[model samples]
Target: MKGFARRQRSVLGVADALRLGFLGLKARPGRSVLSALGISLGIAAAVAVLGISASSEADLLAQLGAAGNLLTVGAGQTMTGTPAPLPSTAAAMIRQIPPVQSVTATAYIDGASVRRTAEVPAIHTGGISVVAAEIGLPKTLDARLESGTFLTEATIHYPAVVLGAVAANVLGINAPGPGILVYVGHEYFTVVGILQPVTIAPEIDQSALIGFPMAESAFNPALQPTQVYLRSAADEVPAVSRVLPFTANPAHPETVRLKHPSDVLEARAKARTQFTGLFLGLGAVAVLVGSVGIANTMVIAVLERRREIGLRRALGARRSHVAAQFMIEAIVLSLIGGACGVLFGGVATLAYAAVTHQQTVVPAVAPLAGIAAALAAGSIAGIYPAYRAARLEPSEALRSGE
Candidate 1:
């Protein structure tokens, strides 16, 4: 009886508990698998949320990150209806601030993409300066020169255009056509050179980036550039919004201000904090549900294997031995289910990345933590049942069969 305690996990290493737990599972594989499925569902739900949540978080981060780095300042709110967008001059003003470095401004026409049918009615067509490159956006947006080079300040200030990848694909502008003419508002411009394709927001489809002055005159003559962007040294970016009048305040008291992208990133971080609690709540509910399965399986295993427990107890086994064995089985089931779920979650993440063409994010510690928690939950569920099994009297259990 004294030696029986030596065989249990309290004395036995983790490796022994695992081996015995797995052995129990192998002996009753069908029942083990059924029990595992319950936990699998719980893990799957948790992992699914994790995968999608991660993707959404990243997209939001990317946008917000863009805003922060490509530090834009402008009058955020417009008159209720008109929403007079931010003026480009705000960027110049922002640059005047001590911490600020270089700045570029663009006034977006956001012209309705002209099309014969409603399927593709509007695509973004706007103007930007070659100077816009310096203002925090060039690297992330990998627009390469395919047939022609990037627009010069001289070329960009005019109607010379660069097409986005999807835009180029949609507008049938991939190859340089001999007699290609593009019409925006019945106005026509010759296709100079086809710029390479890249990722941009969907709202700006069939879009072309032209020279600043050309875009302003063609799309918005009355308004100055609504979007003003600038670059500060990395360490200097923090002070930029505060230093500038247009961006210093939240309500935007000045003539021009736009929400800096960094604000969006901070908001995203707050959202992740909120979402983490939500996900944990969901996991807790799952753990609760999984506990029921663990309890049910352990109870049934105890009843069905009463003879085995009785024999083991009679063979110099201690009460602790039987209890430990039962608990180990439940824990093993949970851990195995968790491992499978992690693999499943990884696959799901890859699929999402493939379909969306976005980067695949793998949070290394989350899966392991998820599994450990499930095992803990299962152990807790098995406690009562294991206690009952350990307390069973062999003579009374034998007489019950009679």
Candidate 2:
């Protein structure tokens, strides 16, 4: 009997194992809390990083959505390095594209100065620009009218002018009405409308827009488009961009420069991953520190509880039972920390999003992955101490503790 192996013991049930595990932690409340804090901090860092990244990416994507499928085309230089102006009919050519929903172009009128009145010194020109604008500009730029109506077909040949937000302020034209005029190109143009703001083209916000007909007939007949703005189906943006050069300038397609502003937003959204990797590295370090803390705490616990281990061993408890008890206690401790960390991280992400005016976003896998990592860390840390505790000889342990 002395030389034979002991029969294997049965494992504890789930509920009973958890009960014993909870009691073991309760016996050392102070040390248990300190151990769990390390785990909580690690999990919190990981979860917060994920949540904040998702939120910021969501904000950028939302802005892209607002931009729609807008594209800007400008004149490019020739092989000789001389700058070129976009064709006068560039907007009309772009409109021929089937997917093109709206198209507008603007040409700067040179040698023009806008003043509140003729009495104002020429040097006092308010830095306002005079541009030839299409009637469809409001739709193309998705601009809002703050005062009177935009240039219409009947008003295109007349001296009607529309003021951007900044231009209106400088010209002392708060509201558009009859008898209100601003001196431009040695002529007085009646202010017909004031625009709120233009997001796609912020330069438009500082300039005065006049109808193309008025610009050609009175201001400058040879004026050509300096910039073109257009919108097409989202799926057709690439196709439209490819052919825009040929369509705008058949003889010299190379003299056109096209840009998709939405592509810039998409690039920014993808760039979020760069920061995510850095944040995740920080989180990994935190988790590593937590794992070390757990391992240290468990080793100390095993040393301090040798007598308890011996008494249980003397009372017919198997070696496996001792190991199971300590291992379960470690898992429970880590779980408690993981849960608290999830709550803390979620609140922090939401609060930050609200302050920054970004949409709150949290990936579904974040919490599950966090908890699983905690469980894995806890299990690995429990192994050495659990085996050491189970290896003690009952009589020798009891004698050594005396």
Candidate 3:
């Protein structure tokens, strides 16, 4: 009894157990690689999905940061469902608000149509609206000109037009230069500028802009402001929005409609978050499948290595030692797969971000969480197999091998 106790105490050291674990994996290199591949693929999928979503969200936030404080005011429909027009003084009224930084307004021309040339049929109006715009519109909206120049004070009274990004494409006009003309309201108006796509103001991207003075002279002298755009200090946006409708229309504040462009963008970001959750669930399913594969592989390994188990038991190795060896092997295999998965996932994220022209943003916790998940999967998968190997009596295992 004393000698048996001494042998049990001498069992297997950590280093020796680790060595045996590695040796077992090396003995069946092909099986080991396949098992690890399963884990790697699952981890990679999870990491890549999270990384890509994060990058996309970061890009959206950056755009919002540029123009999130911009707000739009328009008149709501009257009791008869006819659209109410904003008062001509609405922009001036909004500018009086202490929090308002800048204000500009545009009035849509009812019967005006714009085309590449007068020869084009008026029936093919290309879904584009003609709008009379203020000279300060580009500054108020923080909009960028893609080509040529925006409407200037000097050009406001002339037959000059500025095309929105989509309007330019629809009109087949790439850039504004000398002799570049668009037929507007049955007359030739020189194309003076083309704007870049406005993320915060998509409606502006689809309209053709003409100076207010030009629109009054050529299209309608009685044009009233239809849409009023304003920017406020970032921290004062909410307060400004609350009082904007009242300020824009003091007589009928309820008929004044206010829209936060940033809210629309934020809603889109939230929708993306919901999609990210769905994708994460898919990733989890893949990981579950990989864990099952590892469990199945380990069970088969235990069955195939009965002779080795019996020999080790006969040499006075404790059952706990044998169990620990299998556990370690499973964990090591998963760790290797996890490292590779992180590398592959990170590379995929960077490539996608670069192609999409977005800033890359991977959460620091992603790789760490992946590795932890892999380790946990390994622990769970090794349990039943380790138990089965440890339970075999030395004599019974030897006989089974024979």
- Pairs with backbone N, CA or C atoms under 3 Å apart (clashes), candidate 3: none
How far off is model 3, as Cα RMSD?
2.8
Q: Give me the candidate number with maximum lDDT.
A: 3
Off by over 4 Å in 2: 1-11, 65-68, 106-138, 141-223
Query: Tens digit of lDDT per residue, candidate 3, span 1-402?
Result: 665654345468888988988898899899888888878887888788889999999988887897678999987887788787888899999999998999999999998888888899987789889999999999988899999999998999999989999999999999999799998988998899999998888888889999998898887888899999999999999999899888888877888888988888889999999998898788777777877888888899999999889998998878998889888888888777778888888988999999998888888888998899889888888898899999988999999999
Report the number of the highest-TM-score candidate: 3
Residue-by-residue lDDT tens digits, candidate 2, 1-402? 899999776566778878988998899899888888888888888888899999998776766775768989888899999988887788888899999988889888887778888888877767889888989888887889999999999888998889999999877788999888988777888999999967557688889889888899996778899889999999998898899999988889998998877777777767788888888888778777877787788888888888888988998888988898889888888888888777777888888899987888889888998899889888987888889988999998787677
- Which of the two candidates, 1 or 2, achieves a greater TM-score against the reference? 2
Pairwise lDDT winner, candidates 1 and 3: 3
List candidate 1 segments past 4 Å from native.
1-21, 44-69, 75-99, 109-113, 116-150, 153-159, 163-181, 190-208, 213-223, 235-253, 350-361
lDDT of candidates 1 onward, in order: 0.62, 0.85, 0.88
Which ranking of candidates, highest TM-score first?
3, 2, 1
